[model samples]
Target: MASRTPAPRQQTHLAVLIDADNAPAAIVEGLFEEIAKYGIASVKRIYGDWTKPQLGKWKQVLLDHSIQPMQQFAYTSGKNATDSALIIDAMDLLYTRRFDGFCLVSSDSDFTRLAARLREEGLTVYGFGEEKTPKPFVSACDKFIYTEILRASPEAEPAPSSEKSTAANVEEAPKPAAKPKPQKVPLDFIAKVLDDIADEDDDWVHLGALGQNISKLRPAFDPRLYGFKKLSDLIKGHPKRFELQARGATNGGSKDFYVRNAGIAR
Candidate 1:
């Protein structure tokens, strides 16, 4: 019998399209970082009417991130021209066959069909939006991220009070105790997901694959939602429930991380 040749590995190339009208400027920094986990962002474009003062905040963000801004004027009243422009451009990019996937950043339900259509072509679609994003749009993508998880910490000091409010004259209200943030993704949920997706022979699974499975199971699952920056860190946090192993590449290059339920026999 002839030995089978190994297939060449190719890095995933993704096209990132942001609906500037629907997405927040604050999440742009963390959004790019999250997208980097899945693949390289080959084409980064944001659609909006730059002439509007509301979009002024995105101007500096786009320039700082090297994201191309595509202007789409609101040609008609009570209609979103930006969504139409983004959809058209998405199809154009799809036909080029250069990208392996696409990242659609918007909370609007208008892109639900666009995401489904791309998936039909065997392209991975990653959705980024707020918690209020419609269920149809969230379910259409291979994986979805809530923008709230990407927001910067709110621990910054409050802005200075107005000049008219003197320290002596101003009456301060009683400060309320800070409430603890609820855990969005439970550790047991993650462990259960790993058990179901693990290899039958060895009960071990690639950390990347496990993370993808978790996303598919829970569209809102995010490490940041639970105070961890990355999935690896989250897994490391529960050392008693999860075991992590770093395997060196056969070529002595990089290491691949794997995870399994701690209860499983080694």
Candidate 2:
């Protein structure tokens, strides 16, 4: 694979389309707020029939958020036209090549294919949905966020459960007032992913490149599993087994990745 430029701090342009029928209206405000962290929500559109009484709450939010409402009335019981409209617009926008990423906000698995298709074109797809969403759609996105996490209000107290909002949101059960560190990444598993990538790359590999390779093999393989935000932080926590370099002292290129030795295990 050809090396690409480092990811920009801001997303140049992003297309955000919502399936109004499947998503709760209450999350619209926080949803856009979260998307702003990646890049601008350049194209904001929501698809569903506005005439229905069930969607009245969404009308208020649509105007507040400046989301264009695409009307698609249900032609028959149990039929959904909203999904079709959202998918059509997504494809149309995708062909223009004007956007850097896509945000598909809906709990229904109907858009799973859409998410997978967008990823095939190398677009970063960020999916937002409720906890009830199926695993297939959740795992398809480059990053999948649960609506509950985004919608968590400041006043709302945290709920006690072992459940997680994202596939990578693994949290252990709460203990009796004693806080434990997040579970550490299994050294064996890390070695397997690194060894596999190294074997494919003739015994030498870039740490940054290896991380991407690991993501391809397992979307939920996050450094956060061991309580660190970046892969470098995780590797540093296990430095005896890994080697790293700050790559940019000699040139303008940044040293943002690392490399590993083969056969290193826990």
Candidate 3:
């Protein structure tokens, strides 16, 4: 005789808020799939005016996904009440202590404070936005998912234009114009790390070390700009450019170690 056991439930509760103005309607489907990876999305709300013609596409998405639409009529031209409403709701949710994490879906930098505030209350914040999202908002979250890449199937998106972020939300502020194309990765510093590892007889330096080397060489280096998160994820995405390996721990800590080696491919 055998007894069946109940399955354990995922401990995370995610609240997903989409800014209709900044997010594409088509990303709705891919959005859910991405959220499922983190946890069950118990509270899903989209802020915008549903009666307007501009929101027609999103109306169908809301109905299909059973997302609650919070209607906020545009108070003035070129002004969005959506961001304010979402922030208010986020604070309310934060006080209730119900959600384990908050998913802020918007490319607008307006929510940067909201994300940071939520984290201040000890809640994990997962942000979903376009590549044009401001660095402050992107870095404020525990993790940020670029919706464009997730929407696209297998084929990778072209290299991020150096001007994308600055040109994105021009209505918000003025930014520097783009310059001519430049080298993708700073090779000299990368070469230094590789040489250092070579001198030590280490086939691979910890990805952390590699990142530090890169940062020390270039303070502005960001894996997100290169289409990746962790150094390991970035390295894995560029199989031809670099080789990765799991390295032995230094002491009793079992933190997974990653190593990178030069490859001529890309």
For each candidate in turn, the TM-score is 0.75, 0.63, 0.64
Q: List candidate 2 segments past 4 Å from native.
A: 1-11, 26-30, 119-122, 156-188, 198-207, 220-266
Q: Which stretches of candidate 3 lie above 4 Å from their native place?
A: 1-10, 152-242, 246-257, 261-266
Per-residue error (Å), model 3, residue 159? 31
Per-residue CA lDDT of model 2 for 52-138, tens digit only, reads 899887988787789999989888889887898899999999999999999999989999999999989989998888767888988
Give candidate 2's error at residue 121 in angstroms: 4.6
lDDT of all the models against the reference? 0.88, 0.78, 0.75
lDDT digits (tens) for residues 1-266 of candidate 1? 99999999989999999999999887887899999998999999999999999988799788789899999999989999999999999999999999999999999999999999999999999999987899999999988888877776545446556986788887775343232364655978888888788768988899999987887877667787787878988889989999989998877688889999897765
Model 3 poorest 10 in a row by lDDT: 174-183
What candidate 1 gets wrong by more than 4 Å, as runs, is 1-11, 153-182, 199-201, 245-258, 262-266
**Residues forming the 10-long window of minimal summed lDDT in candidate 2:** 172-181
Q: Report the Cα lDDT for candidate 2.
A: 0.78
True-vs-predicted CA distance for residue 123, candidate 3, Å:
1.2
**In candidate 3, how many Å is residue 63 off?**
2.2
The CA root-mean-square deviation of candidate 2, after full C-alpha superposition on the true structure, stands at 10.3
In model 3, residue pairs whose N, Cα or C atoms come closer than 3 Å (at least 3 residues apart or on different chains), thus clashing, are none
